[model samples]
Target: MQPDWALLLLVANVSTLTVCMVLKLPQIITVIAAKNARGLSVRSLLLELTGFLVFLTYQTYYEYPLITYLEYPVLIVQDAILLMCVLFYNGNIGTALPYTVLFILCWRLITIHRLIIDLAMNLSTFISALSKFAQLQSLWKTCDSGQVSALTWGFAIYTICARIFTTLMTTQDTAVLFRYAVIGVLNTWVFATIIYYRKAGKRKD
Candidate 1:
């Protein structure tokens, strides 16, 4: 990478990581405040968490630059906590144990073969996309934003854009780039849906 591109990449990664550090805090707060997960889709969170884990493993397996994927760990932690909060609010905390074990197993198995990670990385895009769709579906059905935080979704959009740029500068892996591009769009859609529902709810009230 050229020095200028390298510098931009570093900045993008740092900026992305900075946002991710608190990306899910808003949603967690919203959930706690409402004491409900009404408009939130647990499946969406699970798929998103899985995608993060698999993508991080794929990037590490290929020895991608640490800067390029550093946000994944932060995101994983945030999403995991958010997931637990959602489950707890929804009265399904017991289910977290199985999901946790499954994720651990899959994380360990994903790197066992190069092809597995490659295939997983691609499928993760679909899974992650489905996550957004699930959230959209929930929002549509509930017609309420409930505890869904517009701020968190907005932060997600920013991180996705940053990753898209850094991936282009660094690894430029098509799978990685495509993942960011698709999720960026999906995440935005989910964000917009949340905003729409929230506004509609406010107007109704």
Candidate 2:
């Protein structure tokens, strides 16, 4: 018999969380060792942070598991530390335009929607899945390009498995199809970019 879908999703989320946590260690190391954010993209990290916050708001307004709120923040903390190490290399953090604007807009626009805020808790699952997808894509791109070092692809692969599992777990409702599309595009872009870099022999700074 097939396992229960909800159970599968829980298992997948837990497993992905584990892998994400483990993969995160090396990012810390890279920051400390290199003391520069050479290979990392500030825009990507900023986008991820904003995405998670939006999801977190949705979860809280709807009253979903508090844990979902924690996940993205945890990832953000790691990225912030990593950003600190690499900040000087990028010159002013202000140079990251994508990160700045989206992060702010997502928060402001969503917060203003009383309906969205009130219904936030119900959207927790989608938010969690979306944030996870974004972060995983960012990390995979970083690892594939040698920006984050290769000691952690195992973790990344595990995270991808988690995303695949999450996609399976979520119901295929109309609005969600768009969200899934976003995830799919991100996955494709990250993988294709990696392939492009490898073929072109563009060494990561």
Candidate 3:
């Protein structure tokens, strides 16, 4: 790749990922302003946080490029705030504070063997994908798509797809490729669910 073209690709990738991260802002705003988390899944948020944490650990251990892993901490913090909102809205602050402490403690205690960390990173990604399913199930049962920001999911799909493409161009690392593919599929499903439920609700009106 030419230097200019490579820089363009780098810029495009980072810009798209930034948009994905920014998309969460609306959700955070909605949750706070509405003071309700009707359709949001705390489990899903926590699972996402765990996945990011593990990925962060993996990247730091392996000394990956900053661009590749820079967003993990941002995402972890965003999810943590969202989790706090979920807890507060549900009147579970006592539980939330202790859980936060425990999370920090557990993160500190984890031993960082390369093989173990790699396995855990993959496992956490799988668990995050499952968590998306659980979140979709919640939306289905409630028929409430309000808690999920379609914009966020849409940008997520874009980000994951872009990452997959970038990975293919840069390195054919099967693990990275598979992880993003799974996440992309999951995000697409969630976005579809949001549209389906939104249309269903409107038709009922």
Top candidate (TM-score)? 1
Candidate 2: lDDT over CA atoms? Answer: 0.56
Top model by lDDT, which number? 1
| Clash totals, every prediction | 0, 7, 0
Clashing pairs in 1: none
* Candidate structures ordered by TM-score, highest first: 1, 3, 2
Q: Which residues of candidate 3, in runs, are more than 4 Å off?
A: 109-111
Give the clashing residue pairs of candidate 2, or none: 36-86, 37-86, 58-120, 61-121, 62-120, 62-121, 63-121
What's the residue-level lDDT of 59 in candidate 1? Answer: 87
Say what the RMSD of model 3 is.
1.8
Measured on C-alpha atoms, candidate 1 has an lDDT of 0.90
Error of 1 at 119 (Å): 0.8
Cα lDDT for residue 120, candidate 2: 48
Across residues 51-160, which tens digit of lDDT does each residue of candidate 1 receive?
89989999889999897878889989989998999999888999999999999999999888999999999999999999999999999888888888899999999999
Clashes of 1: 0
Ranking by lDDT: 1, 3, 2
What's the lDDT for residue 48 in model 3? Answer: 79
Per-model TM-score on C-alpha atoms: 0.96, 0.60, 0.91
